[model samples]
Target chain A: MTHHAPTNIPTTGPDDLVVRGAHVLDPSSGLDGVMDVRISGGRIAEVSENLKGLRNIEADGLHLFPGFVDVHAHWRTPGREDEETIETGSAAAAAGGFTSVVMMPNTDPVIDRPVVVSGLVRRVEGESRVRAYVSAALHEGLKGERLTEMRLMKEAGAFCVSDDGLGTQSSGVLRNAMLYAKDSGMPVILHCEDHTLATGVVHDGAAAALAGLPGSPGSAEDVATATALVLAAETGAKVHVTHVSTALSAALVGFFKGSVPAADVTADTTPHHLTLIDELVQSLEGMYRVNPPLRPEGDRLGVGEALRDGILDFVATDHAPHASEEKYLPLEEAAPGFLGHETAFSALFTELVLGGSLTLSRLVGAMSSAPGRWVGDGAGRIEAGAPADLALVDLSEEWTVRADGLLSLSGNSPYLGRNLKGRVVGTMVGGELVQDRTGARFGSRA
Target chain B: MPARNLLTLEGTSRADLREVLDLARDYASGTVDRPLAGKIVCLAFFEASTRTAVSFELAARRAGADVISLSERGSSIQKGEGLIDTIVTLDSLGADAIVLRHPAAGAARLAALHTEAAVINAGDGRGQHPTQALLDLHALSGHLGGFDELEGRKVAVVGDVVHSRVARSIIPAFRAAGMELAIVAPQTLLPLDAGAWGLPVLPSVDDAVDWGADVLYALRLQKERMTGGSPRVPSVPEYARFYGVARRHLAGGAVVMHPGPVNRGVEVAGDVVLDASSLIPDQVASGVAVRSAVLALSMDVARSRVAA
Candidate 1:
């Protein structure tokens, strides 16, 4: 078998991240044109046709687009560098065209209070080239009880309140959190996996029985999702799903699209979930393993189809990272979730875009503006007053995902060495160069 | 017609019939990412297989479709996820094809049940592994120029025949291809229906060897499969002394073949698999490719009728 092809990087000058020539695409602004954006003092000065005394660069072979915003990303700070420090995670985000990411509060010391949220935000700001936002926990410690001080955390710079690593089963607790969230004017992004049906591993199906592992059935996610929706509708708070990996959950998203006010309920599916399942996970050993574990291949395709049909909200890399030594066990024993930040867009492009399941505009909308609208983030559109958060992608470059040399700290991407037909060549955050071909100019690898 | 590859024997004209030769070629040469796109397969294996079962499962998945492996271990036959209930369950679950491996002969045909999906016989106890037999035929054709021309060619299948399911299945397939088979085992080892299988039976491997054997297949002891013991070989050492393929015997380019999990020296030398004429690896490789095509074809047949 062939190892993944070496990443073919363009031999170009390394100044600031600039793409002067490619067609710009921003679905939120109805923008599609050959535009030029000028970066100065780490902010967009202008986006016009031509300008003298500017750093003249070539972007003829690519497509300029708004930087993707992953509202739900499990980006740990340098505090625990072994399990995805901020630098490594930010590098992954940059490679995926994500200039801004709202990290989930599921670290060792879960970010619940203003102090924790502020600490994480400042840590990421000081360490990462890519912009980082904090989505602190709703409950004090994510113990499934007692609402955290949502207002104080938001004022202290928490982007949103989310109990994402797990969901609270008690309706009273959820209702209180959403009620608090409604008051705070922020959404509660929930990880819709019911603990009652949570088997600590994967979906209980034919594959689970054959492998003799515990099953994390679809009913679990469905129940939690329904409960969250019921609470959201009652409290009038926005509820979003972090990483949806099942068809049963996807059908609920379809219901959301047609449901009244179309749910303020948004959901995102990971590229790993969109591409693989329990059977493939079993074949690849525990390497194919992930939480909300890869549902079967049927569900994988269903999640992709739902995204294409506008039933699913967006695509996010619940890019949880773990040390390499942790995955040396069977399906049930190994840790769940795969690192997918770097290969996110490429895998989606291969499965949905190249397979003709999703159009390019749809892909851009789901990856960028959709999440932007859901989180109320400033990143996504390329309108005149918008921040210069952007990405330059070459849609025709056929890149291969090689695990051994992957940028993410964890080598858990299921698409390792899978053929992909597109690549993000350059990424910009506030018009400053976060990542490009030469090397990261912010942190050591950021 | 797009030339549907029929997995069943019924309603298959010679024109519709996919020749064993063509199936082998398609498997060997063709490649597709989503060969079974928008499809689902209900895999029913009555018996267990670690290698073959998992291989076929991987093949179906690699073709990009859904696969529902029915739980038959804790099944209540009719009241349970038995053969029929399992098929019905798959139908309700929107399965587009079925890969059936049963202990009963002709189970693949019986399980088709009028759905549009192709019912592929992964293997049926002693009924047939048509794909395996076809692969065998293709191997023999390559070695001896063609099955039609193997009029005088001799094959030595030693040890057990009475309890060997492979012997029963390959007999008809070989007969269909017009190749004469030489059953080389003792009277205790030979099945009473051996002549009814329409082949000349011999008393020992030496008979075919003396008659200039073109191929040798040393059968597995099959201890796990045997419910009761029949004296096929007086002793394993005795059988090996008389019929076991030695290195010197296969030096003349005569091939050695076995289904697998070869019992090192009891049946044949350890070096036999690596010998220039062994067909073992090629046979193993074909299991995946042929199953992929069969899986894809089955799905295409069922896709139109199975609903979202």
Candidate 2:
């Protein structure tokens, strides 16, 4: 079986332009410092000082980096369009400087069948502004019962298979799915959670106890992660654990990555998990509720350290969107997720980069090239002959995250009302300026 | 500043507790006045309850307030109406005080955000039952002669303390009232990092007695805890042998109190439930007076009366 790299369907044709004198930073290509990047036919034609093109846009003060690739996001398409549609989800992704986003298969009708995968791919092509890849479900209806037609789904343009929003409960079932996924050459993205131990709404810790909210222990995520890592090592299957919230789970991934070198086991922690703690639940806001619930301060620090140390592979937004009605209720009754896409970068830049714990180079790499490599095809770098998917950020610009200012249909971000540093002023997907907040002028073809 | 609502006793001050308990004492001594007259007090219970609902309703009526009761059985909540919508509806209907009992933690806080009315949390899942804590304090204080008499008193909270809103509310409230507290439960039944609460976790009810506990506060043990797929306790009889407060444990001049509807043979022995030393009935009686004071204070009625 052959595996195809996920495709991006840009609305406009590739631009013939040069981004002049921008402080370009691409960690993957080791390209740092001010450079003029010329784009031709949606590919980076050259990267050097004083590069000339048909049209030029001056970007002297901006910091340019490869557009972020989110390995995990939920568009909530086809079913809860009110919550988030492909158009809006992609818009939110673009607003956050994400040029490529892999949508989870937990949508209505469940992206389990080949038809669903193909249909979603087509919809994303027509509706999405960025390069949106479709991830088919590993289990039928995400019930953890039977396996989906992974080989057929890959044939239909599915980049990967996942049962996100729910974990595959039985180890035997997960092992079989992994084996089948290996045969299909599809990366299995897992939402690791042992349901029996994940019975509570918030993290099982001092915060949850004080808040009087039911606490779901971190062991839930840790146990499932261990199982998946063991199975991945045993089967040699490509496994990506999404939303690794617990410290032990991140350590387990590190252990497997070190000990079982041949095992293709990668993991990601959400921006919320890295920055926020379970103590936020003390406010009793339902918006704080999330799957593999927000953990203690130590877990947050550990996860952040793991991401910095490359123990955790990269960051994924788990960009779940829900109507305000779903989020404004009590913690137990509210839906467990946060609108993650738009706030991912700024929240990280402010909390980690500026906080002196993590470097901007490492942060950019994790958000861009690191996750970009997982999606394949040299997608997340600004080197020549690479896709011109890029973002122009103003690192010094500070803005408060207001609910009404959000691009996603849902305004349930934990960062809402908090002032954050750094802003993605411009985002380009396939040489097209899908989001141009910088208001820079492009000269006519010369 | 006096609190406008009684959500939880976690941050409540000694002065606030003293004011409420003192007013409750006056209320018990037949100080009858229409403190809540002409005010619309809405009792919105989305969960099942017997004593809390009845006591709150009775308290509002005795305080001369116009009561509007809404339970899940007969209310719009039964039709999948969310707690926020119900709270909004009550607020729109001129509810001056919204007494909420919901199965979701933080329900009252969520309700309070949407309404101008004062919010009193009757019970919100395992979140808090502040009034119950206050009433337990009132009963303990009254039985021991006065509030000052509760100083340096040791109270042992036994049973499903993790799932008990009563335990959640009382632990803080009692501690603030100068009562030393210890938790008595198996490891499985305690909250995560129970040590963070700064209270000792006694191994057994007998150990609690040996620790010189003046009051054995038995929390109601749900039968589902034992019979559920992941049983918290090994068996009912086994749980009784350890955490359960029997007559023998209370023989050291220690009073037995329960946030009632107790399991006869589980958390407390059948004989000890109505034993001479049992303050269970007094706890029930204190509910009305304490809730009356809570309603009056939350509505600012007691403030005006005290000033007068």
Candidate 3:
């Protein structure tokens, strides 16, 4: 592994190591108990009680799980690097216990062509602290008019195809894209929002009403979800809705998942959608402004129920980052997006699983095996011969989220000043202790 | 219970509204004078307005506060200065209270966050027009006997409720004043979340009159925005026929009101602005007294903060 230090922090070389006296959890392997795990040469060497290694780190009173797989995060590389880069985003992801994350294709030029996909893959291999996968735009330049060359993008190492920020409006255009995606076996990730219905910046409910801002009705997501699911079912293409914010959208996904198993349709909810309600958007600063905006309590609790009932497949932070000045503008003028990659797991674990809205196993599964399989990555599991991607978390630790303390360059987060319960103490990617309790730094070059 | 900034009436307590209303009553009766002397009030109107802007200036001047007016086109705002920059500049230039009227819903709150000056929303876009609602309260109170009489009274707010900042603010203010409120507008003019207001949505001005509403508060037609291509209203005549308030719709002893720049024939019947039962002028006259109370109320916060 090679390294690039964007921030001043000491980096240690790869070595045979053991994490002992910790609860090892992996939903994929059905392993949940106190154990010792050994890693060497970027691979898991052993997993059992009382294993010895050259160097051992005490992990007692900690819960160890497979490094989380996040399928939606905007690294903003190739352009918008001032907001985020693959290196900085990967470090932030690692800090948040995400060993692998799929980057969105909503960059300046957008990752539609094979060249961009290959370039991103090379950069991720060279500079990233954790594994990075790039999703290519379904339409060329994400214009929603012309289909991109899917086979070439896939060959160039694009994990999926998406027109994330812009929904493909024309049904014919979307149908063709789904057909091509089916042929290429690339999952079509939909940013489900009907632009005409999504007129405002906030949810169409009590919050927007009381705030007196224009309302983006829940029907926006419901309409788009229906459109995409119909296309996915028609073309037999694998479709995944990113950031499902409405109960109706979740119900549609649930219906499709239960009724049409061959459609290969799945959806992931964001931490902001799963935990925070639209009421929070009324009080918080422009940091809570986001696309497919924060929904009311009905949708918030609805998505929670969807997650518990297997209607929603997993959790992924739509970790969109914007420049501070852009976010500091008034609610209507400010650019939409906020910091999420660094706070996703902690916020979810604290608000959902620990708060009794979700079980520990389900949350781990959503973050790990489910999203891992969505991207076709052989990660999100802990077993001998499997990749040594892991996170050691102190569930009882209470810490307030602060901008000055986060690793991401962008500090826009609704969770600012909010005290959360779970903390990621350490993250190991490919047998390398990339981050620990001391704080995040670049990983090894060995 | 004084508001730190009058952003919305949603979280405002009854005590806070009462304090301002009582002071406004004193101003209306000419019993209060120069309460805000030695204070500085900056009126920053980023959107075009006449009544809200002029009344705030008059109120501040009458209260003996040094007042500065900043309009969007005439100021550095036209030279591309940001809202926060303009607010902070006013704060640094010694504004004790900032009266802002911008076209964004949360503009006043955003300004409040960036400046130490007391921020007041004169009228934010489709957001709360707190002082407008306050003056409306003053006028309605005088016409309906007293504040005590407001408890059982019914006010039907007709016309463009969706785009009316006045409507948004008045809904909660009137509700807090113990008045039963009903809305009469075309479905197009109603906000998608209008149900959240918890007010009865009446079919038309006629139904509201038939229902024996004591007051008919009409909002601006906003026809220029509401009646273009893909118009919210099909035609001006159609909307006027359905939601508009004519003289005949006014029941005996019933009053008519408009936050002015009223589309004379559209939202109200012709010559109805000067009708015996029309409280339109009284609403405008009440603006001076109510705003004087608002200026003093907001500056009291700044004064106490400095003293402490």
Top candidate on lDDT is: 2
TM-score for all models, in order of appearance: 0.57, 0.97, 0.92
**Judged by lDDT relative to the true structure, which candidate is superior, 1 or 2?**
2
Output the number of the DockQ-best candidate. 2
Model 1 accuracy (lDDT, Cα): 0.67
Query: A86, model 2: CA deviation in Å?
Result: 0.7
Determine which window of 10 residues in candidate 3 chain A has minimal summed lDDT.
A1-10
The C-alpha stretches of model 2 lying farther than 4 A from their native spots are A1-15, A440-446, B1-3, B303-308
> Over the full model, what C-alpha lDDT does candidate 3 score relative to the true structure?
0.83
- Clashes per model (N, Cα, C within 3 A): 5, 0, 0
Residue-level lDDT tens digits of model 2 in B1-308: 33387788888777888999999988888765768899899999999888899999999999899999998796798888888889899989999999999998898888888888999999998899999999999999989999989899999999888898999999999988988999999978877878769889989999999999999999998888877667888898799999888889877799999988989988889998888899999999999999999999898898676555
Interface RMSD, model 1, angstroms: 17.8
How does each model score on lDDT? 0.67, 0.89, 0.83
Reference A-B contact fraction recovered by candidate 1: 0.00
For candidate 2, please provide the TM-score of chain A on its own.
0.97
Calculate DockQ per candidate and list them. Answer: 0.02, 0.75, 0.54
Q: Which residue pairs clash within candidate 1? A: A202-A216, A290-A337, A291-A337, A401-A417, B76-B80
